[model samples]
Target: MNLDLLLEQVRSTSLLEWIAVTFGVSEVLLAKRNKVWLYPTGIISICCGAIVLIQAKLYAETILNAYYLGMSIYGWIKWKSRNQFGTPKITSSDSMDKVKTWGIVLIGWVVLYLFLINFTDSDVPIIDSLVSSTAWAGMWLLANRKVENWIWLNISNAIAIPLLFYKGLFMFGLLTVFLFVIAVLGYFDWRKILKEENNELQSV
Candidate 1:
């Protein structure tokens, strides 16, 4: 990679892409800390990202970001709900929940793949749909405070990093790498929390 060219690319990044990157990073960091503010930050990020992706002709990514915006709102409300202990709770997903979540991913991938293939001029429809579907399932699990969300999110990040870089969205690619690390940390953190919660309940 040419240093001068990389610097030029950085300098030439659009305002919307900058906003998307900024808030997207914030969203992941906040979520790692189990903060409620992640949802609003994510909403801002994806809205900006949608516009940037549309301009880049990543139509499936654009639609994925739109879905992200809606899921952000749903996540916000869901996370705000209180348990009987009058606190927000994080929990591990049950076996059946895991099965159902992956089922959604499979169905979503096929549907998105067909839609992008027929409706858009996307050159990487399969990869785009795979990323989008996994992300959609991950977002749903995250909203419900399921620890398995990190696994799904990491899968999406792995696929998206190369795709974003290939599309010349270097900044977004780097951001996704950052997000992948955060998701790994978040998985362990949430698992610890679940263990503590279980211990507390058992002692009662």
Candidate 2:
């Protein structure tokens, strides 16, 4: 893409896209810091993102964002239920939770893939469904502060970067790059926190 054309595209960007990108960045950074505010920020981002994806004819993505809105609210409530110390509890997923997480991913992928193929004109149904389903599973894990959420989220971010770029959504594509890096850092940060918490429990 030409520099002038890219600049023109940026200038022509809609308010919703800008809002989505802004809140999206805030949400990821807050997540990295283990802040409770991430959910509300995510809700705002998803609301803007839903409109933008709808306008772009990305029906799967639009529906995913709508789901994200609900997930964000649920995550907020769940995260608010802190431990005795009034801190949000974090944990690693056990074997059963891991199995259930992957199961959700598989089922969501199939359902969305069929929905997109049968009901919509999505040109990239496979990628769309993959991203949406994995993200759904990731959000579920994230609500409970499971360490594996970062892994699944990064998977979605990696796919979303190229997908958004191909769709001419350069801003969101760049945002995904930022999200990808942050999620990696988040994994390490949360892992360290979990380890320290475990150590404290053992000492007690």
Candidate 3:
């Protein structure tokens, strides 16, 4: 199958939208396998997302996408390191102290909500915050290799799909729906990996 056909769907869409979706799918695939390279893929999507949302006149999403770009850079650096083979492997999972994990989650959601509410006048204020916050948490969890990130991704997709479709981004919205299904499978897959790793460590 000529995957090039996918580009046709993008033809009617802006370049940024196409770029964002392509890279977003790539990021999700890389993330499913716990690859550190997901960060760069995410960065590509984030940059394009910012542009696409801005062009579409969705200022709040535009800003969030910019923030995503910045976060991607940080995540990339944090994940890059040598694995058992001394090859560059992004962290599959890390021991995040419970206190720090909750702290970051709390602070991130609060800040994202407050910023959106105060800075934007969209009728779907809470919905916007919900998607952005969920995505931020998911991204952070993904950076740490937490299996829980897929849960957040699923939540974000639920909100994003309708929102994008309503906003006239049919292609982007459809993509989010596809992502949601993929994420569900990813959750189970990652959980299995984590369990196997834990069992191996216990045996060792």
Q: lDDT of all predictions, in order shown? A: 0.91, 0.90, 0.73
What TM-scores do the predictions have?
0.96, 0.95, 0.79
- Clashes (candidate 3): 0
The reply for model 2, stretches above 4 Å from the true place, is 83-85
Ranking by TM-score: 1, 2, 3
Model 1 stretches astray by more than 4 angstroms: none
lDDT over C-alpha atoms for residue 177 of model 2: 97
In model 1, residue pairs whose N, Cα or C atoms come closer than 3 Å (at least 3 residues apart or on different chains), thus clashing, are none
Show the lowest summed lDDT stretch of 10 residues, model 2.
81-90
Supply every candidate's count of residue pairs whose N, Cα or C atoms clash at under 3 angstroms: 0, 0, 0
Question: Could you tell me the TM-score of candidate 3?
Answer: 0.79
| Model 2 lDDT, residue 1, Cα | 81
Clashes of 2: 0
Scored against the true structure, residue 120 in model 3 reaches a CA lDDT of 69
